[model samples]
Target: MSSVHVEPVIAGAARETWLGGSLKAFREDPLALLCELHRASGDVAKFRLGPKKLYAVFNPDMLKEIMVTKAEAFCKGGTFAEIKRLTGEGLVLSEGELHKKQRRLIQPKLTRSHINRYAEQMVASTLAHLETWGDGQERDLAVDMMKITFDIIARTMFSYDSKHAQDQIARAFDSINHIATRKIRALVKLPLFIPTNENREYIQALRVLDDTVYGLIRQRKAESSLEREDLLSVLMRATDESSQEGMSDEQLRDEIMSMFLAGHETTAHSLTWTYDYILQNPNVEEKLMNEWKHVLNGRRPTVNDYPALTYTQNVIWETLRLRPSGYVTSRTALQDVEIGSLQLIKGDTVMISPYPLHTSERYFDDPLTFRPERFEQDRMKELPQMAYFPFGAGPRSCVGQHFAMLEMVLILASIGQQYRIKRSSTQGALIPEALLTLSPKGGLRATVHRL
Candidate 1:
């Protein structure tokens, strides 16, 4: 376990004296205010986001120390509890051995080999969509990538042969995002959602999502197709190693919704940012193109090409650093803890803002610049550990990080090899829309050109 260099950061603000603070900043625009906080407080700053909610621990070293060292002392917090309104007891909110068991059961579906088998699906779906684009026309790259990725994950995970399956899965994801953001932004946390018409709509959306996902699970079981190699089938058949517990129908709903919620937008944002970076830095795109053209030899790139595809990885890493989709994570202290002289009572929300940490002046030299070469294996080793956490670190770290990275790499190589990306307009600063995941406030726009 790592210990943060105990630097005292104190706040006179009582738990009752809390103003909007970090949560308000999050409500305003999540990224900008967090960067401001990083500048104001050093390693472990004290913040009051929303009334009475004290958010401490905003630095990397302390991030690891708390999330790993004292992780049990901190669970998902009210933010996570709030998420349970929609997600139920899915892996995202579930704690204790149950989480471990659930993660173990689902782990095999996202293994490297299983994901690699899905590479062809990613490539084929991406090309099929790109083929419809006309030359020099502007398009919202964010929406297009969302459509492409949503379709790809379905095929790779559910063998998306029918329009209905794809539509149900995609609708579930969109509906969930809408409900989550609305719930997260509400001023009063608890069951306050019931009386408001705004939250009333979310209830309807959740039901729609539940129905569609449940129907798919049932339909697949009934069909019992011989061609059931997708992640959905894999998950449907998964059982705990010891107790032999399997996902119940409701449990399956939670897991499917969790997968749908977890996968789509984050990967879409990475690719969107990657596309934006390649557009701005023509040299980087050209280098990636050269690598793809040479190694692929006109065939679609595969896992075999990953090692040689260094620059492609560079672009993705740089995007993750600059515009990571996992902008902020919250952990509530379950036990009193002290860091330096600051004494923490339980119930304080520790806000982990990676956007500020990743771009922190102390951490990355010229952190704002778009340079993929910074991720060169040797160069990456120079930084202090946990300073960069697109997927976070520790026991609760994202289980699907490897799957996402592979999906991004495979898609970038296949698509970049076949097309040249041009800047449609640089209208946004990768603005942090920070709802459930960090998203661009304005749509991500770029022009796609053929090789």
Candidate 2:
């Protein structure tokens, strides 16, 4: 009998020949490497990150299969594990039954009805932040955006408005975000118990955040009889339908930290890029301004104006496509599964990046160009659902999507109504540095022009 030779289905094959597989390429420029791989391999591309196997899924159908249809088979693991260190068992990191229960409990707070109540506060916060800006004065919109979003989240969610407390929380959160981003991709990671300088700093940052969050929770608990409109108050009052149980203090802390990160960082990055792209494309700004004029008519935008503000919403959509806050999200296979022709065994990691898909020539005409008209009603109807999901899709989709959309629209409208931000001559091109959230590197310096 002749000896039979068979090649392994997925393990040994690698697109790159380097010792570290795609890690070296990914480390250099993650977005570029993923885009290259998608172009070369089509929907599904198998590669390695160090010793781990990763499948880059580019097609809408394949993405749907992983994120929606077979979502249970692919759990939030790997990179999320790193984030869990900061967020604990919050909605973003929790898995299985715990995740479902948490979602059920939190869903009501983010409902459109509840989110509508926050509209006035969102615009007020933006206007308040704009007071710090001067006409013709150069300012970093990145910092300004962060400050405004942070202020909004603080006032709307926690009902905490002390500037000193907000500043302390902001500083500690920034420290944690910086250290967590560095540690997420590091080849070697030391445990928290280890007394390394980096570990010490990370722990201290965690301590500051915990202290602040715990203080808020305690204050809310003491004021249980007092009815409030804030999210924290709602969450404190929330009870599970099945168990009739409320969240614990630790659970509250985790969810608060998750909210602080998600509610602020992502929207701030989106607005910063919105201005960057708007400044780069004068036509876009003109259209946006025209839409605001027609819709709002010199009045501040209300939640009711969203349907009328089509072009303004379109600009936000286009910006999200070009620069998504959650640029690349991943999941690990919990069991053997067949995604098209590829057989992914248990523990295999699948990366689905909207960046490559959004920028691809196949799905978009002149993909590199910034044209918000592509999202017009007729055009958008023809596009696939998975092709443009800035807030993500499926059961694991962002629960705060409604809240975020309304807040972004209000802020953008409020800012554009009073001022036009142009890039400063001293600042170079805006560069994206993919941290926990995709943020503009070196901040976005621009001059505020009063209308």
| Superposed model 1: Cα runs more than 4 Å off | 1-23, 162-179, 189-197, 224-229, 240-245, 338-342, 425-430
Listed in order, each prediction's TM-score against the native is: 0.87, 0.93
- Report, for every candidate in turn, its global Cα lDDT versus the true structure: 0.71, 0.81
lDDT per residue (tens digit) for residues 1-451 in model 1: 1011211222222222255555655566656655666666666666665665555466555676777777877787777665676577787778778788778877777787777777777778888877868876678888777878877766776665534455555555565666677667767654644667756656666777777778878888888463577767767777767677666888878777677667777999788877766766667766877888888888887777777877778778878987778777788778898744556788777777777767766877677777777787678677767778788778788888877887888888777766666766655545555677777657777777776
Best by lDDT: 2
Clashes of 1: 0
Best by TM-score: 2
Which residue pairs clash in candidate 2? none
Local lDDT at 394 for model 1: 83
TM-score of model 2 vs. true structure: 0.93
Please state every model's RMSD to the true fold in angstroms. 5.5, 7.7
